[model samples]
Target: MMLSVFILMTVLSLMMKIDNSISANCYTCNPCPTPFSPSSYLVRNKTGCRYCAKIRPDGYPIVVRDCTDTCEFSTWSYMFSKYSYNCCTGNFCNKSQTNYPTHQMVILLLFTIYLFVNKTSTKI
Candidate 1:
């Protein structure tokens, strides 16, 4: 029972740590302009925790933070249609007007650790 309690506490702590790491704000706009300054807002996508900035080959840019449901997850690439997409996780990550690919590896690492701890706690 004590071991279970310890495991549960550890899991809870890890989850709290992960939850606090994400920024509460993100940039959202349609056809975000060059020399852009995007307005920030609290993220509402819940599971759409990723931030995306897509620049059409024509130079029109879209900045938004949403889950995979809203924006299809893809690696950095320019489709034949001449559209380039970049995504990163973190508040305001999409604020950059330049479509440089951003990687949220730290967030992924922490999330993985949280999941592992949670699973171990359940077994306890």
Candidate 2:
């Protein structure tokens, strides 16, 4: 019984460590301009107009239409990292977004560990 408990603890600890590592390696969005425009001169062409271009969170270039001005231009673009691309035509990466399945899995793992520990400790 003790051996099983020890193995369980080691596995749980390893799982948690792996999760932390994955989270650390996860990509993060660099701060960029809002209503990003590739041709707008309002912000000195590039100044105050931080931009990012990279693979979308869903692994697709976001389709964006610019209506900030009278004209509307639509295009597909990926914006994940700042200064990665000269022009952005869609929403940039927002790291605040959470993956429900991953979150649930972590929670479930923690809960299972809790229950296991409790059950093993009780004499009943």
Candidate 3:
């Protein structure tokens, strides 16, 4: 019974260590860049930084990726800039994506129907 208990404790410790493993690399370049992003540059992530950061401003062509000592997940807006700031503990997590929500298309369809109905009723 004592031997079994020791083996169980050893297995649990190994499992805990595996769970604590963190990605140790970060990309120091913007994952995605646009015309409005003055310093947009992208490069593959290598072993780097304590934390990784990506920032994008909504409806504005702004993008940033960086290595930071400390970071947290957050978002904010100022002036003409609506910013989404994301800070992650692992460095290999920054990747560029171009996407649009399907819900926006649904909203557009509804708007078009409303306009058509309003115009037809006015004429009648």
Give a tens-digit lDDT track for model 3, residues 1-124: 4565466557656654543355446555544544324243455555646656667767756566666655544322332255676655543554434223223345556656766786799799
Error of 3 at 108 (Å): 39
Better of 2 and 3 by lDDT: 3
Clashing pairs in 1: 48-67
**Candidate 3 vs. true structure, TM-score:** 0.39
Model 2: weakest 10-residue lDDT segment is 64-73
Q: For residues 77-114, could you state the per-residue lDDT of candidate 2 as single tens digits?
A: 23333222222222322222322334436666776887
Model number with the top TM-score: 3
Could you tell me every candidate's TM-score relative to the true structure?
0.37, 0.28, 0.39
Model 1 local distance difference test score? 0.48
lDDT score, residue 80, model 1?
31
lDDT of 1 by residue, 1-124 (tens): 5686577568767755664455434454443444565433332323335334444444534433332223443432333344555555555556565544333344456556877898899899
Backbone clashes in model 2, listed as residue pairs? 54-78, 54-80
Give residue 81's lDDT in candidate 1 (0 to 100).
46
lDDT scores in order: 0.48, 0.36, 0.53
